[model samples]
Target: MSPVRQWHDGLQRYGLVVALVALILLLSILSPAFLTVSNLVNVLRQVAVNAILAMGMTVVIIKGGIDLSVGSLLALCGAIAAGLASAGFPVPLSMAIGLVLAVMAGGAQGLLIAYAGLPPFIVTLAGLTVFRGLTLVYTNGSPITGLPDTFLVLGAGELLGIPAPIWVMAMFFASTHFLLRWTALGRALYAIGGNEEAARLSGVPVMRVKVFAYAFSGLASGLAALVLTGRLNSAQPTAGSGFELDAIAATVVGGASLAGGRGNAWGTVLGALIIGILNNGMNLLNVSSFYQLIVKGLVILGALLFDQLVVRRK
Candidate 1:
């Protein structure tokens, strides 16, 4: 390849990793606390939830689909798990029921998109509202507290001196990486995302794979819920509102193609870290939440523009 072409390819392949390193360095210079151990740990813990959600979002987007209901799914599942446990059900059983509900919700949306010919966006949008409503009904618009210590440990406890949520996030990221890099199902996801019709023609189980992608996304939301609930010591029906946007933003910023068939676990993790660090640094500088939102939006827009101009350009 010519030098220019090689340069462009390198930029596309290594851009996210480079950007994350640059971001960390910039933040460290701007905020003395940015590199402190306690602040770094805080960033890790705070980012764990979004990182987990982004992993799921990465998979769904890779399959040429979007799920706008994951935030609602998180709330509903978290509420169900925390609510039942608080109401005296066995903690483990309550969590399982909540996770099952999450999978069902996602599978239902996937079926609509894959088999019923409904658009993923519309189905998930409806689910966003519907699931939130179900959560309110289940909790009577109240937070669920008094969770058992055993269940809370999943979210709030520490293991190997690291926060539980961070561990959970790491596990999910590793699993996602393994799934995309080393499995037949991973190949199928790419094929379907690259071209659904062609994949079906090639004997890929396109519909089943589609369902699996969304279901996996749902499972991620449920796992995030567990950590979030544990961290807060309660589950609120209103929790996870707008979290879908964060997950999508992180996936896109991490270099995932919105047109599908491209993304990586490391990139998504770095994206989440960048966002988390960005917010943390801004807080250290006392930037207003309003300005933070604008800056963050611009950053995502920049990433999308770069993807279109450099990564996706022929």
Candidate 2:
């Protein structure tokens, strides 16, 4: 490639980095408290789960698939965890069940999409409703509260002076970064997303990889559920509603192609941080919740438009 072309490609690949810096500058200008250590840590804490989920979402989207059930699945898994704890199940055992359920849910969705040949949208859309209903039925439309002390600690407790969730988020990102950067399976994920037919012909395990992606998505949601439940000190049946949109927005804003095969974990991490910072900034500035909704939607649209322009230029 020529020099100009190489420079342009570099800019496109680092679009998320540019956006993140711009957001930080804007927020610092808009809010006097934006750059403080406490607020910065708070922002990181808030973005932890979203970032974790976005990492998993990046994998699926890179494989040219979508998962709309993540939010509902979070609520479902959280509710189950809370219910189990309330019923005297040991905290560790209860969390294990939640993880198993999450993987099973994702596996089922994968089977429907890959082996049964259903569209991913339809399969996961059905899952969205099913899991939402399950959450409500299990909790009887009420929030499940009074989780064991250990359960609360999992979400709200700190490890070595850092929030447990933050630690979990860090480990997940580090591991996923390695997987995406160094493993054959990781390369195959990109290849499958780039072109499934060609990847299959090239000996990629398309079906199994697809299954693993969805399963990981579910596992991420489950982990998020644990953090959320601990933070709230309860599991609201309505918790995590509409969260999938935020995950997708984070992935897209990170420069991941909805068309597939072109993004990185770090970009998604930055994207998730941007979303977290935006929310925190709005709250600090006392932007009305209604207006905040409008602003967020506009920002998402703008990001996609920016991405389109950059892609076209490349």
Candidate 3:
């Protein structure tokens, strides 16, 4: 590649990092509390749920698919965990059931999309409603509380001088990073996103990979629910409403192309941080909640526009 092209490519890859730094600097200037250690840690804690969700989103989007149900799936999974916990199940066992339920839901979505050849958008859209409805029905439109102390610790506790949620986010990111950078499945995901027919012709197990991708997405959502439930010490039937948009926004803002085949775990982390920072800064500045929604919408649109530009340049 020419030097100019190389520089452009580098920009495309690291642009989100630049944006993140710039955002931090701006926030630090605008809000006196933005740079404090406590506040910064707060940012990471706040972003943890979205970051975890984005990790799975990175995989799904890379395979040219989307999962609109993740937010609702989170509510459903979280409710199950809290209910199980309240029913005297061990914390670990309850959590395991929650994760298993999420994985099963994801795998079912994958089966439909892969074997039944349903459009991911349609299938997952249906899932969004179904999961949310299930959550409400399960919880009777109420929040589940009185969770075990051990379960609350998962959300409210710290580890080795860091918040537990941050630790979980880091571990999940590291695992996903390795999966995408070093695994054959990861390469197949990219290939399928780049061109499904070509990937299939080259002996890629497209259906299997798609199934795995959706399943992974589900797993991520379930994990996120655990953290959220822990943090809140309760699981609201309406929890995670609109969370899928934030996850999708984070993935795209981190430089993942909506068209697929272009993104990474690190980028999603940065994207999530950017979002977390934006929300934090706005709250500090007393920006209206309505305006915050507007800002988030704009960010998503801007990321989509940037993705289009990158595609054109290529």
Candidate 4:
């Protein structure tokens, strides 16, 4: 590679890490409480759901696709389990049903896009609307409560002296990293994202790989739903609103190209931490929610601008 090209590549690879460290330093200085062990644990707990979703979003984006329905899907899937549990069904069985539905919902949308030639944005957008409606209708516009501790353990319970959600996120991050780094399916995803037509002509199973990508995204939503529902000890029909944006922001900020064919598990984790730290700091400093939203949007826009103006040239 040319000198400039190598420099840009290195920047793209390590920029997020640098940004995360800088953010942490800034936060720790701005708020003495930011470095406290309790505050750090709080940040970890909050990062779990978004990080898990981002991991799956990374896969779909790396495969040259986007999923706008994940937030709504989380509500629908979590409600399924929550509703069942409220009706006295076994915890595992209810969770299984919810997870299965999430996978099917995600895969069906993927199939429509891959086989029927529908645009992914349109299909998932429709899913976003449809799933939200289904969630509302299923729960009769109310939240499901009366959850058992057995079911809630996945969200609020600790394992090995660490929060369950943290462990869940760690396992997900590792598995996703391994898949993208080592598996043939991972190669197919990247190839398709880099150039779909060329990849198909090169004998890549483009459609199947795409479907798997979407389904995996669904599974992430499923897992996130369980944690979220557990944390709340109830499933809200309105839960996960705007979560899709958070996931995309993390994926984009983590060095993934909006144009596809780039991103890594570590980058996403760092991105999530940067975001978590920023939010935590903001809350500590008494920043308004309105400003926080603006800041978040600008952060995402900055990532896109950096990718387009600096990295894409190479």
Instruction: Name the top lDDT candidate.
Output: 3
Top-down TM-score ranking: 3, 1, 4, 2
Report how far off residue 169 is in candidate 4 (Å): 0.3
Ranking the candidates on lDDT from highest down gives: 3, 4, 1, 2
Q: Which ten residues in a row have the lowest lDDT in candidate 4?
A: 305-314
Q: Report backbone clashes per prediction.
A: 0, 0, 0, 0
lDDT of 1 by residue, 50-111 (tens): 99999999999999999999999999999989988988999889999988988888898899
lDDT score of residue 268 within candidate 4: 89
lDDT of 2 by residue, 1-314 (tens): 99988988887777667778898999999998999988998888889889988988888898899999999999999999889998999999999999899989988898888888899999999999999999999999999987888998867899888888788889989988898899998999999989999999999999999998899889988988988898889999999898999999888888788888887788888889888888999999999999988988887888788778877886
Instruction: List runs of model 3 lying over 4 Å from the truth.
Output: 1-3
Using alpha carbons, what is the TM-score of model 4?
A: 0.97
lDDT per residue for candidate 4 within 1-314, as digits (tens), equals 78988987788778888888889898888889999999999899999999999999999999999999999999999999998988999999999999999899999999998999899899999999999999999999999999988999989999888999999999999999999999999998899989999999999999999999999999999999999999999999999999999999999988888777888888888888888788889999999999999999999999899978766476
TM-scores vs. true structure, each candidate: 0.97, 0.95, 0.98, 0.97
- Model 1 — which ten-residue stretch has the worst lDDT? 305-314
* lDDT per model vs. reference: 0.91, 0.89, 0.94, 0.92
Clashing pairs in 4: none
Model 2 misplaced regions, further than 4 Å: 1-3
